[model samples]
Target chain A: MTGDQFPLWAAIAVSVLLVAGSLLMLAGCIGMVRFRSFYQRIHAPTLGTSFGTIFILAGSVVYFTVTQLRPAVHEVLIFVFVSVTTPVTLMLLARAALYRDRIERVQDVPASKDPLDNAEMQTSKKPS
Target chain B: MSRVLPYPLLTLSLLIMWLLLQQSASPGHILLGLAIALLASRAMAALQPEKPRVIRFLPIFRLAGRAVVDIMASNIAVSKLILNPNSDMTKSGFLTVPLELKHRFGLAILSCIVTATPGSAWLEYHPEESEVLIHVLDIENDQEWIDTLKYRYETLLLEIFG
Candidate 1:
């Protein structure tokens, strides 16, 4: 209604992006609650982290770019940081969980092996 | 170039990231970013991580495109599985797949791709055994997941990194 209102097409695109992002994030949280085990729970939040965050950030980028009348790409930093850091934290946490499961002898975890010898055996088995 | 910047790509990306963060490309910011990038690359040199070699560039883009499509499809699949009340949880399980790709950087990228996709989490990777264990949500067929990784991702990664 106002003079400052977003253009119709831009508004539609932004709305769709934001809605899809929120839905993905909501689904991710639901997955966390619905899953049965720690391992399973780990996969849940990735939904939010991967495409969810990307969609939301993209929406922000589109909205700001239109409003500012310039290329507003700074939101990409959040995208890059989130995409990189989430995996690192998740990987570390997964490794820690693996270590704990091995130490505690928790059920269903693959057994740990000698790092050095295992590498050698794999290399030796290479067909080349 | 090597003497001044051990990792030219790292330095360039760091400088670009600094400029992007500050949202400026003025001379002062450029100078500061260059200095920071130089210092950071020097610091990185001390750690001495193995240098990643990208043999073919086109496959990287192809892989990225495939990943985006796959992630989008899997996101829908996973959301449906999670939302369904009657879906069985017992079907989800951990799987170990042997890998032939040996480059450390390639392996790292593969893990990121796997984890970033919804419904799959990279659990444990044994470099010596050339195997990685992943926790998959709603894994109806183990061979399907194995083929997805080995053929879809690993082959491209080997082409790029080897």
Candidate 2:
């Protein structure tokens, strides 16, 4: 946010990055409404979470490093944290959604997956 | 070395995370961060998660680079699909992809890659069947998508984790 100390080229680059990141995020939100199915809607926010955040974080890093005269790659923690955690959340959510759809005997659910019964809803289904 | 640091890599990363958060490399911060990292690593060791044995290191970077390129490309594609009025929305659907890479860690990384990209969301992984169910935002062709998953990412993952 503190960009007054930034020179002309840095300002342009940061602004462009920040704007592009915001636009990607805006499109992601719009996608939540634009897409119809719950499954399809799941892919929307990743636009913001993945590269959108990257661009924005890059801008922040550039801004801070230039302004403070220090390496501001700390935002990499956010990137690493998100990359590590978002998949777990999205996978669980998608599995729960798919489970509910399968249980309700919803049409168009992938036939390859067996319908979950009350007893079989375990998270450790992966073969260790 | 192994006795003092049960998980050297995990402890090192935690220490680095603490330093990054503090944004300082001062001696006081380093000692404090080391203590915190040791404590955290001990706590993590209590959970007894199976440490992934990465057989090769180089392909890991290659896979990451390829995934980055794909992410950017898909980000644009999905954004265009979101914005265009005349875009065909019906092409989006679920696809069952048969996977050959079965290493648990490899599968975990694959899930991250698939879900981290904009145009796809990994729905369910069938470990028993060695297949995964993924939802594609724009499924122009099922075979093409399958090939992309298998060849583009899975092959490199096999090199790194399999």
* Highest-scoring model, TM-score: 2
- Taking the tens digit of each residue's C-alpha lDDT, what string does model 2 give over B18-128? 889898989999999999999988898888889898889998888989999999999998999999988887788888888889888888888998998888889887777
Q: Give lDDT tens digits, candidate 1, residues B1-162.
A: 777899999999999999988888999999999999999999999999888778899999999998899889889888888888998877888888999998888988999988888878888787778889998886787888899999999999999988
lDDT of 1 by residue, A39-115 (tens): 88888888998889989899988888888755676788888888888878888899888766665567887777756
Candidate 2 local Cα displacement, residue A99, angstroms: 0.7
What ranges in model 2 sit over 4 Å off?
A1-5, A112-128
Docking class of 2: medium
Per-candidate TM-scores read 0.91, 0.91
Model 2: pairs clashing at backbone N, Cα or C within 3 Å: none
In terms of DockQ, the best-performing candidate is 2
Q: How would you encode candidate 2's per-residue C-alpha lDDT over A1-128 as one tens digit per residue?
A: 55465599988999999999999999999999988889888989999998788899999888887798678766898888877887789989999887777656577987545445444644324332
Q: How many backbone clashes does candidate 2 have?
A: 0
